[model samples]
Target: MDIKNKVIVITGGGRGLGRAMALELAAKGAQLALADMNREDLDTTIGLCMEQGVIARGYVANVAVEADVEQLFQDVVSDFGALHGLINNAGITRDGLFIKAKDGKVVGKMSLEQWNQVVDVNQTGTFLCTREAACQMIELGNEGCIINISSVSRSGNMGQTNYTATKAAVEAMAVTWAKELARYGIRAASIAPGYIGTEMVMSMKPEALEKIASGIPAKRLGKPEEIARTVSFILENDYVNGRCIEVDGALRI
Candidate 1:
């Protein structure tokens, strides 16, 4: 589908990969409904999109909240009249081993709080947003695309049981949605990024960063725009569906 003049909604569009995708889509003449909980960051993103000369609006939303997700879609439809695409990019991480470790030794079990928080935001949030977007697309009776932001860690990560599970579930939902929504002309796909050098990664210890980078075949981390480019590819390619494109520098985590 041509991105020009298309109405696209991106969850967690205030910063990181979400912000990058928003700018890229806006540059292509897409009308953007950028949603995030951080009002300041959302405003910054809006400014950047406006600099690209696109019509973009920012909405403060917590994707995990069903009411927020529902209202957000309604607001987008009200503003843009129709929704063409959705990028389920909002996610959070609470890293902890299922068996807690201290100094590489087993200490205790992971907290229920940690597990539930990650699952609530990453998995449930994606589901709610996708459901609302699908409803809107079906209502309009037009073909649309939905891209879920997954992670290479979905296969499993040492200290990311909750995070990995949530991402894995996202890919599963993507496949299921693709098959179910196909009749309605709505395609669903996912992008699993490897070690990307976003602010989240930058916050890691220097040695830890080096260790992770060494594992990647590319010998470096990925850029947010690389993921954004993949999103654009999925949006423009009508035949691609029910697949998770791994943008991981050939690294299997």
Candidate 2:
């Protein structure tokens, strides 16, 4: 599981935790095939990785689409000649209460659209990407690793019924994949991160951020690099499989 010169594919590599992971792996000499929906962001991440003196390429892709995901893996192998790792980091959040009520009367409920949007990108996207990646690995006789980016909210969050459901599914999927794909020399695992200092999270009001940090035992937000490092650890450790690592700063919810 040596990372040097290994070809790794990272979905959602345009920004945030995915970008952090790309840089970390590049620093360790892993070749990168970065996929994202944003061309500009993808190019920026690629250039950053290239500056680390590793081979980095960018592809515009939507992971929820079967055709897009299949083509992504094919394109990566065509370019790198092998697939060694995949990070299912592409996800979106559509937060809403399952049932919003006022004065004992139902005011609103989670829309099918909200549920489908999150499920399609987070849960189904992970499934599609992992299936295609596993096929590539087995056919090429390459030992590989797949890491899904789950969330602390998988346990259930008040305003995130859709997001929570999908997060839980991705974690469960990694466990199932670990059991199913062992004979093929591929390992599957997941990482659930707490509130991290990503651009989106950091942009929240300072008072809101402080309240979040106060709730965690660590009394601070997790760094994107912390999760990125965990990804590298899992990929490099052959024995670490079928488990979800919580980088949540001791947060329960």
Leading candidate by lDDT: 2
lDDT of each: 0.93, 0.96
Model 1: pairs clashing at backbone N, Cα or C within 3 Å = none
User: What residue pairs clash in candidate 2, if any at all?
Assistant: none
Mark the 10 consecutive residues where model 2 has the least summed lDDT. 244-253
Residue 202 error for model 1, in Å?
Answer: 2.2
State how far residue 225 of model 2 sits from its true place (Å). Answer: 0.3
Per-residue lDDT of 180-201 in model 1, one digit per residue for the tens?
A: 9999999999999998998888
Number of the top-ranking candidate, with TM-score as the measure: 2
TM-score of each: 0.96, 0.99
Instruction: Supply candidate 2's per-residue lDDT for 218.
Output: 94
Predicted structure 1: lDDT? 0.93
Candidate 2 global CA lDDT score: 0.96
lDDT of 2 by residue, 34-110 (tens): 99999999999999999999999999999999999999999999999999999999999888789989999999999
